[model samples]
Structure formats: C-alpha cells, structure tokens
Target: SFCPDSDLIRPHRPVNPAAASRSHQELHKELQRLSQEGKTELQRALEKRKWEQRMKASRDQEEAKKSTSPLHQELLKRHQRLENVLSSHCYCCFQFLKLRQIKQRQLLSIDI
Candidate 1:
C-alpha cells in the first residue's frame, strides 16, 4: 500500500473575482472614451469643410456682383473704346511712314 505522503505535489492559487471585474470595467471605459474622441474629431473636420465651402461661395457671389455693377460695365466699355482708338491711330501712323519711305526710295532711284 502507498503512503499518503508519497503523492505528487501541485500548487494552485484561487482567482480574485473583484480584480477581474475591475479590469474589465476599466477596459470598457477606455474603449468608450476613445470612440467619443474619434467622433468629435470627425465632426470637427466636416464642419471645417462646410465652412470653407461657404466662404468660397461668398467670394464668388461678391465677384459676380462687382462684375455686374454699372460702374464696372462702364469702365470696361471705356477701356475697349480707348483700345480701339489707339489701334486705329497706330495703323494710320504706320501707313504714313510706309508712304514716306516709298517716296524717298523713288527719288533716290530717279537721281541715280
């Protein structure tokens, strides 16, 4: 017959239920906090995009209003008329110079 003290020995420790519960609760809270932070960041990015779009639209409207104003139209018309007058004056001057050169060449040929 085997003696009772001859059996193999093993070590066992009891689990602490309170410690496990606290750890689980802490993990859940951290997950919730991280999720909330992610949502807030996404919301902020969307709002910024919308604000930029609105600003661009406002700028475009202002540009359109300026271009359609009576003063701006009148200025554009005046600028166009001035350009036409200058171009016509330049053309007349070029023609006069060409005629003078032809006359000089003819006189030189006749004398030679």
Candidate 2:
C-alpha cells in the first residue's frame, strides 16, 4: 500500500462525453443570457439618444422663437408709431367735426 510507484499504477480517468455536452449546453445558455443583456443595453442607449435629440431640437425651436433681430425690432417700433399716429389723427378729426356741429347749433340758436 506504500509503494513508491503507486502513482504510476493508478488508472487515469477517461473524459466523459456527457459531461462535455452538459458544459457546452451551460455555455450556450450563458452566451444567450449575455446577448440578451447586451441587446437591452443597446436599446436603452438608442432610446436615450433619441430623447436627447428631441430635447435638443425642442430647445433650438424655443431659442429661435425667443431670439429677435434688429430689423424686426425696428419694424415693430415703426408699426407701433404708425398705429399711434393713426389713432391721434382720427381723434383730431372727430373733435374737429364735433366743434363744427356745435358752432352751427350756436348760430341757429342766435338767429332764433
């Protein structure tokens, strides 16, 4: 039982085909799980990119609406001045017509 050559007399265990098949199946399942996880991560990244692009476009549109040019500002000021001038001119014309009517009435009363 204590022979120095016992290591040389022990039989080598043969490779089992069933064990190899089981390991291959486990590896296949693991690869499938990793692939599914990678697909999910890729999908999340794509969704985030789309959301960011949409946000950027929305911000650009808002900035465009808020931005103004010197020409536009000048035009707006000119439009406002024209409106004021028209309103004042119409008011003066209305006052002038009322005064004319008042004077006619006064002259009629004096004649009576």
Q: Candidate 1: which stretches are off by over 4 Å? A: 1-43, 46-67
lDDT of 2 by residue, 41-109 (tens): 467779999999999999999987899788998999999999999999999999999999999999999
- Cα deviation at 94, candidate 1, in Å, is 0.8
Pairs in steric clash, model 1: none
Clashing residue pairs in all predictions, respectively, total 0, 0
Candidate 2 displacement at residue 90 in angstroms = 0.6
lDDT for every model?
Answer: 0.86, 0.87
Q: Model 1 over residues 61-102: C-alpha lDDT tens digits?
A: 998976687888899899999999999999999999999999
What TM-score would candidate 2 get against the native? 0.46
Residue 6, candidate 1: Cα error in Å is 62
TM-score of 1: 0.52
